[model samples]
Target: MMRAADLPGVIPVFPLPGALLLPRARLPLHLFEPRYLAMLDDVLKTPHRLIGMVQPDPNPRAAQEDAPPPLHSIGCAGRVTQFSETEDGRYMITLAGISRFRVTEEVGGFCPYRRVKPSWEGFDRDLARSEKDTGFKRESFLDLLSRYFQAKSLDTDWETLKEADDEMLINSLSMLLSFDPEEKQALLEAPSLSTRRETLVTLIEYALRGGDDHGLLQ
Candidate 1:
């Protein structure tokens, strides 16, 4: 319901590792932590009702045992589209992803939740529902996916996966797969649908070969 121009310069952030929310996808979150519960309450009072879904930066150099881990620079902002309060005082909510943003800087505030100044310059196109991945060849990709899933001892409906469009098939897999945090970040930061698909293929190929995390960046 919020327009692109209405997005704020500074927004609240939730830095949970391994959670990937791509544009046009919905991420369901169960909020029990006091800070995040407060974050949900505060955002619901706003017109935009959005929060940045970012991952904790996994690089050892960016972290210290005594302090909170640094957040990755890039993340997607999602608007809360559904909400319900549980009897236990927790919140169950669904976020409909709007666009990706880069963390320009962390804002110091008294609010319990983290906030960051977001730069939404390069991701305006994310407002659209989907994009064409001209290079996507469905049949072969599914074959590779079958092999990877079998190796991981995972089961999925081949028909369901095959029926998804280019963007949905790629983004859903990118979000749902059990890839490491760094790889999930890479998928979230991919410049286009084609790039994400290629990265996904490369990842699955590596996982089939016993998962060389070091070589994924190469």
Candidate 2:
């Protein structure tokens, strides 16, 4: 058992450009960049393993990036469980979700990745395990999602989607969908699974209507 204050919440974080990790789920990452490879080594050298996952604000026009993109306020802390180094000097790793964290402060570190002090006060255990069945509407919801994916020419496995647990289904789709930054932030900040589900349903409905708007995915 780890206490909030003793857990070193103010630690280095690597921002993944297009991934979202929900509590109790796992995220596999391929790390090739020098900065992130160093970050992985540093985290592996410690016992309290945790890092944040966030998407970079898309900038297709930038000729050269001056620095890493600004991260969103809300992110889930993931524990490094499995890691391997490739012959080409890349890291293949898996992160198991721990909890959602709110960034309190950012600090410059030895590595290029950003560090954050998280507010872990009042973190609830029940909220993390509260994955419930979606009941009758689940099939219909999935059907709508399939249609939307086909129209957009997105690749997804309907069979795997059906077998995925609640967190996997919700978080995976949320990360892949073409939701705007504001909406993505809202889903990241949503307090619980049910709330995230509600937001997802609304977003799916809006998308099915052929609207490319911010509110659809937020």
For this target, which candidate reaches the highest lDDT against the unseen true structure? 1
Score residue 73 of candidate 1 by CA lDDT: 95
Per-residue lDDT of candidate 2, residues 95-182 (tens digit): 8877777777667756576788877654565234546644536787788888888888887668898998776788777766777666
| Best TM-score among the predictions, by candidate number | 1
Where in model 2 is the C-alpha error above 4 Å?
A: 1-6, 55-69, 133-136, 154-156, 213-218
Assess every candidate by TM-score: 0.94, 0.79
* C-alpha positional error of residue 183 in candidate 2 after TM-score superposition, expressed in Å: 2.7
Give lDDT tens digits, candidate 1, residues 1-218. 45678999889999999899999988899999999999988998998999999999878888878866799999999999999999999988999989999999899868898999999999877986588899899999999999998888999998989888999899999999888888999999999999999999999998898876664763
Question: How does candidate 2 fare on TM-score?
Answer: 0.79
**Cα-based RMSD of candidate 2:** 4.2
Error of 1 at 169 (Å): 0.7
CA lDDT of 34 in candidate 2? 85
The C-alpha local distance difference test score for the whole of candidate 2 amounts to: 0.72
